[model samples]
Target: MQSIRSLAARRLRSSPSSCFTATPASALGPGSARFPMAIFAAQLRGIKASSKLQQESTADTIEYSKLSDEDLNEGLQRETSESGARKPFNVEYLRESMARRPHRATYDFLSPGHSHLLNIALWDALPLEARAGNIPDSPQSSASEETSISQFFMPSASAPANNSDHELPSGHHLVYFPLQRPISLLEPDGTDPAQSPGVPFVRRMWAGGALDFRRPQNMQLNGARAVCVERLDTPNMVMRGGWGREKIFVDVVRRYGANVADLDPSPSMTAPEKLLALENKVWDDADFEERRTLVFMRAKDDVPEEDAAEAAKKPKAEERIIKSPREPEYSFSFTPTPTLLFQFSALSYNAHAIHLDLNYCRNVEGHRDLLVHGPLTLVLMLSAIRSRNTNSQVSPGRFIRMFEYRNIAPLYANEELRVCVRRNVQGRAGDERSVSEPSARWDVWVENNRGGICARGTAVTHV
Candidate 1:
């Protein structure tokens, strides 16, 4: 099979007009007369170049050159439908694709190393007071000993063979990342395209998510293997700002449980049958469940020259700001640095350019700087709740049972942001809280330095 580089080269040689023209020597300045022709000859002499080289070089080339004709047509149909044209949107196709579930389950080991590294990264990002009781006192202790994660690494007899001593933390499950796509398969924005609603709706953002620790004790750090079964709900169309601007919201549900192989052994089953059985068992015996809402919208090209100048004149941080109305009973402020963002990205195996690439964030996403990851904010909220519980004598043994959160706005790196939590009454009248069960509800949010809430959530805890 011919590589894309060879195919591009062959096409360029066959169609010189599509690439470039050999400039006359008289058109060039002194000492650079033969530069263009020489480079052109070099490219023709089997010097490999990317298929996108010519397209990227030309100003008028279509931005969606990577997409197939069918994909382009589908996107065009959606655009026309949004514009009140007779062509209807491809609702059937969207429903079929988005609602499909994975055929096989993905597995990951509950490695202590993953937990330890995440703990270290979170410790560095936390304020001094938040890290006060969490870390050990001895300066001479090992790096692992300085964080609470060290306790999980200790040996436990009851732990699954080769697993850690303690159960995984509330939000530490983020570290057990999903399957990653190879660079060749990733979108231009450095995101996995498997779940994307194809073509023009390529740009994706983590809009919000929820976590339910139904049986948290089942997931431990003992190096035992666990399985995750994922399925996507039907996509919902949302109108944003004006009439022709549409966004697609996709809800991804993942259930984590012990690997079925370890629990049951059926040698007579075929591979596909075994996988189906495993997925069914996981759904029934899941230790915890996570649902992430991702929003996909059309990609924005660079602003035109005339508008670019005007946009440059305005301050990057001069957008609308909405402050939180509820005062916090506990708050911790810390600025996320580039290193912290990079570390978190690595821990989560998230290659989204918004978190790791500053240029992509500014030039493509129109952000002031690198954006803080949605999952990172969730982790911070969990950390804040854990810290509050650790310091309070009333609920020392309380654990987070359920958490629901939404991302309201973007939070930039190197900006001071505060994680705030306010305690609320346990439950409604005649509910579980009205009984002897000691529980609490907390309103948790993260606000920027200007006191604008960027992310907010609610957490329910039980003793």
Candidate 2:
């Protein structure tokens, strides 16, 4: 058999530059320029190469490093064909599953108590100095205010029954738990398998999501009724690594609107008609539109044993750490305790084993400890943005209009997590006027203790 290096050299000598061109450091932007070419190739194809490959191939020692993108994909396709052509899930079943949708709109009352509990949980998780501006004086004077507390938390005044004075803070809607399915309906990982592709593609991760706040004032925390209309888009499958490492991406779209009976007050409306009208109204006049992208992969056992062992042997500090490109205008560090994770899981009604059961995390998921909820990181990023705005020169009246984020890696409990926010400067270097205009666009990220950016996002604000 030909040695990997020799084969690589032969390919390099025969292949034209057009077949494989090295991406320039400038093209990759700032911090990403430090990554190896092999890593870049992996990222370009959305393939997360095993840590063993990453560790073994240093800047000076990469095997088959000059393989063209086409060559790599061809090899993957060849391997897939050789693996017996059996699919994990039936395509017909998947199509049937995608065709199904909830017939009625689900409703949840905007409870101040739920938001208050989340506020307290987050406050307790932050350091004393980090909590400086988030103190609540009254129900309406808490974090969601433009001036007083952090804009991420609901005011204490809103916590009382029948209080509809305060608006629900951005990202606080996560606490208004979703309707739960029967215990027997949950997947082995403790996730609701309602919209899942099927078995074997069981392990789920929140890959990324986007939130659009159209009318923030309409989503009040006044114990008023609210409706959420959810629908699942068609799923797309991608070959992340190889046959066994395949991943399915599912997009969930949720629209939130106030459940006011005045929309259609005809007493003659039937039950189904009322529900249909409510859903239509929610979709047409949604106060908040959210898109959540979830990626599902095979269970840990399905991964090659060699790869799993190599991952287990790797030190946490040595794991791939992607640094932030810009310095943060505001940064806050907080260590997530087991109790904090439990509280957040309870609040979100997420029973995922990776966030709760240590044995499952270590033995099954191959994680060192319980993982932090992905949505929790999103909340932290939003909070950091609000906190930075409170202390910075940005206008207090401005609110987050659009926010989008991607989760790159897992964050574990008992580890220090830092939320960083920086003002986004647009336009060319000579254009000071554009760069200095209140920085309506912002860059936000969450960093682990090792300086690895586990999650990164962008936020657009409007006055």
Candidate 3:
């Protein structure tokens, strides 16, 4: 049996959500499918040792050395009120509160359309424009045991090669993740009272968040020799409540970019010409036309139901069916299942009822099936690009400096999801000689079975 601490670490490595472990799938009981009895055992025997390891790895003593005494006092004053009784929110204090080992996440983007039937199946899985009507009639729409993914579980050491030739897509880092202290550390009355103070009636939850994409990441280059730092500024906290429930809203800002291998580092700059190239990649002519068509269709959809019916009864304008773009430079499709959701939830220590409770999702949340984790889709997108970048011509040491994304819509279980990325047009002025210092950008998006873009964003890379 794996030690509890090791198992927790393994689970954390696989999913960035929270630190919760699941019993082997075989151990799942029909009645206890949603709530396994094994998790009720409160004592995690090896957690103490693991806590020590975390402390040793994440202590901020060295970082503290870089701060001046005056600045240090300011941070302290900001963290504690005048008498040091009430805890004032401090940026440095918050960063120190959430500390853990550098995160690593790995994913295997199972290929689509490998088998003959699978191709037809994948075609049918796409949204209308993407499928291009190639789906054979009566082709199997159901998933089979053979089609299930075999490598959903990723270990820490399996972290995708940061030095790969292909630049990973924006928003890929969510595949692996971050932390809060152990339960014992969070409750002063428990183990080490001196380490943490207890706060009765305090509740915390992951409110939603957003990412701002400043530039693309060069997957072709590696960042092993580069120094990367993520700065988390203090969050603006707001309080709101109604219907006997109160919530705290936290708005945080995080900035991350790469620098040279020097002891003192600054933002690694990208060449202006490379930036121009990335900024220039636009949709092909056909794609632009297709988008206009889709936009028109969408506009008609917004008409009131009564108006739509009347419009349908009247003479319609000539419909222009614009041909959509075919295969992109990088594409991968996968079916997310209940098991995948459960594993992800367990790995992230998420107990949100809507994710696992069918009744809640259907009755309370009004979702058709268990909802797919939104972050999971972004991870799949980035993973596909990373997989492609491994074979790309770009050099190593190009790391993803920033990625920004938002959920345009919700995704459900057992849906065939597609991730696609195409390099923006090359710079007109720069020759192929600038390949080594290439600054590339990609138009990245995730499409549904109906070929509708559910989420769209860009990935920029610099060397």
* Backbone clashes in model 1, listed as residue pairs: 163-222, 163-223, 164-221, 164-222
Backbone clashes for every candidate come to 4, 3, 26
Error of 2 at 409 (Å): 0.9
Q: What TM-score quantifies how close candidate 2 is to the native fold?
A: 0.69
lDDT of 3 by residue, 318-424 (tens): 12212226557877677877877776565444445556778767764446777666656655544444443442444221333223344455566777767887776
Candidate 2: pairs in clash: 139-156, 139-157, 143-150
Clashes of 1: 4
Candidate 2: lDDT of 16?
A: 17
- Structural similarity to truth (TM-score) of each candidate: 0.70, 0.69, 0.38
The residue ranges of model 2 lying beyond 4 angstroms of the native Cα positions read 1-96, 127-165, 235-239, 262-270, 303-318, 390-398, 426-439
Order the numbered candidates by lDDT, best leading.
Answer: 2, 1, 3
Q: How big is the positional error of residue 228 in model 3, measured in Å on the Cα after superposition?
A: 12
lDDT (tens digit, per residue) of candidate 2 on 13-111:
343110111211112112221113233234333667566643443332232234444554454454434443444433323332343323224567775
